[model samples]
Target: MKQAESVSDFYKRLPSHAPTAVPLDNAGIGHINVFSRETCSVVSPYSRRDFYKVSLIIGTGRIYYADKWIEIDRPALLFSNPFVPYSWEAESAEQSGWYCLFTEEFVQHSERMHNLRDSPLFRIGSNPIFFPDQVQLGELSAIFQKMQAEMASSYPHKYDVLRSYLHLIIHEAMRSNPAEHFAAYSNASSRVSALFLELLERQFPIDSPQVNLKLKTPTDYAGALSVHVNHLNRSVKEITGKTTSAHIAARIVSEAKALLQHTDWNISDIAYSLGFEYASYFTLFFKKHSGISPTQLRGVV
Candidate 1:
């Protein structure tokens, strides 16, 4: 298997030209194109890029992501976040399906769309896989069909129609699978976790272009959170089942993969972009977690 790049790698590759500005071709931003097996099979696990994809399965297949294989059957609703590398393995070569490609901006402009974040099921980090019931399947199919009709229409406000239609399906999916509530926790624990996640995200786009520099250590984050390092560690461990440092490292690693796969930059450029002073240090850090060297992952696709 080829090595996988990190989440940050994709961000670096955000298309220079604003993603195609062409008007809806019978379908708006939420356009659903029925793909052939030959087209679908081209999506490889080693390649990395951002694309909002939803597949309505007509037959059984296996999807590989985040180091796990999820079996997808008929009436299945599978959503993959942009930048997450996924590949399909199906028993039969004659599988068929309607595939939709969209952008995050299309759905994120509304108030109701906030549920996309509250519900971890749709997010990239948390794997949200759903096997819908027959009734639910019919309901979702109707929504897809409605979108197709509106997109094909020449209404002056067709974009709005397309956006609303997409939002309806997203909201319905969120309602079908309610977000899991965490156990009641004291204010301190909750505050600590929230702060940690924020701090972790900020460490990205680091200053160096040759290697990723260690920004905000555990103590650094603890200091910013205004808590003792031990207390911060305890709170993170109790709430997330992982240490503060570990969480930070994971996000950093994910970002590194994103930059590597999506951008045209050389290893040194990528290393420096992530805040590393020396490319070797970043390589060492990545290999420790990903089990492969930076150079080996360049042509992963």
Candidate 2:
């Protein structure tokens, strides 16, 4: 996967005259920025972002996220996370919106905030687009309006208030978004399962000690594939008759055995190449699955 765009790059892409005082991300807000009446869509190249964004867009456009596309003819809210790549194309020239872009650390101080990646709005493979009803739209926009006001306020505890507002918006979105976003599970399961297997296979060979397995766990693969971890597990299990983690472990153990038998690299190097931080951890994992330690396997083979 390609590197995600950073919040600094995001600022540089904006118009030279974009408001410099809209709580720019590098300020004391801890890498969070807010904008209103930002008529231009500054997103480009259709790649992931290092920061998460929640946009209140009031225009007609096609939103491309992950492998899916959504058309919007009405006011909508969108959640874009660092885990997924996305971009937008406006069908109309006139655009009005509020957007808040913040890094994960900005709101990760609390237990609930730590689960941001697993939330309904930002979770991979979940519907991030929501078309609120007219009344709901007004309410949502009002919240953004307040956020803007709070960002520009002189209050010492404004960010604390901002956090509360952010929570409210997220909760409201999850509660109010329609349930029509789900596709047929059987169809979805097969498709996601195939993609998951392919992605799982692509990280193979571990040809060098310097190389690291990028997708080491089901959660890591879920983030890479832009699907919720539970959803990915369910789909893979239903389609393959085995848990996703089981498949991952089986493949890793297979490769470990082969590496042990074929290569003279030290166990620590092999462990590092296979995404383990320590040889002991990898040894434990290998012995648990193979009934022998890596050294024993190498000696026997």
Candidate 3:
């Protein structure tokens, strides 16, 4: 399990089976449905590499993220970039939904569509769910239908057609999205959260000891942000619904897992590198949050 460190690290663990979900043999993209309630209920913890996901709620239930639960009252759009990890908890086997997965390259390569980055839906470091009315949902679904049609059809410019339809979907989403939802985060609490998120993202892909410069404590962040420790925690908790220590620990745990998975470093090396005074202490901390020991994660078990 990857620790939910930076927001990007959170995203990197998003799990989906896009390869088998899509029907095309050489096609790099496709869509599928993930429904859970009884046995396969929990989405668990996983990440994505090259694909981005957009989900439309067709069944009824809750969507969990950001330490809070969002009720999916109606059909709505949920966006997950390649950088986040998300999961669902099930009381039973009663959840269902449609999830669309496509490669960034495919979406960006098709000609004349609005850039995916411009859609406001695909922006990095932001995760705002957009709820649409009946009329708008109908329009958006039409665009998706057209794209699916183009994918299935044998046309000279099928890819181009799909791009055009996708552009329409994005534009409709932009046109219909509630502007205030995006704007509400622009105030004080949001700014602090944004800064913290940026700081968290910068610590990753640490290639060496020099790269692991000590972001040693909460005060290091509070001092840099020019706010009292209490005030920083208050604002962050207000906006994000999690405590400062939780975020910090989460970030450290996230980085620790990434190193364990992607690097050849030993436990002591990783522990000292993350600023732990003792390897045993680091092991305990990692196990507490992630439910597994680092050594076991490295497959030495």
Report the number of the highest-lDDT candidate.
2
Give the lowest summed-lDDT range of ten residues in model 1. Answer: 10-19
lDDT of 2 by residue, 1-301 (tens): 2346787777777766255665454354466667874656644456678888998889888887654579978889999888666778888777898888888877875556777876768866578888788888888888999988987887887877777778877877887744633333469899899778767755654556788889999999999999999999999999999999998998789778766765678999899999999999999999999899999989986
Query: How do all models score by TM-score?
Result: 0.63, 0.61, 0.53
The TM-score, computed over Cα atoms with residue i paired to residue i, of candidate 2 is: 0.61
What is the C-alpha lDDT profile of model 3 across 1-301, one tens digit per residue? 2333332332344433222333432354332223222223355443332356566555455655433356766677777655444444443345444445555656656545336643467655455477878888787666666665655566866666666665666566667645832565568878887777667655543445324536666678788888787877888898889987888898788778876775577788788878887889999999999999998887952
Q: Which of the numbered candidates is closest to the native, going by highest TM-score?
A: 1
For candidate 1, what is the lDDT? 0.61
Error of 3 at 61 (Å): 3.1
Determine which window of 10 residues in candidate 2 has minimal summed lDDT: 177-186
Q: Stretches of candidate 2 above 4 Å error? A: 15-29, 177-235, 239-301
Q: Write the per-residue lDDT of candidate 1 for residues 1-301, one digit (tens) a residue.
A: 2233332333233333112433323243332222223335533443423446566666667877643568765657777755455666776556655555555555555566544544455554555566777887787777677765664566878666666766666656656645343334368887788667756654543323444455547888888778898988988898889988888777767767766754567777776766666789889988998898877776674
Show model 3 residue runs off by greater than 4 Å. Answer: 2-46, 66-69, 88-97, 110-119, 177-196, 199-301
Report lDDT per candidate: 0.61, 0.78, 0.61
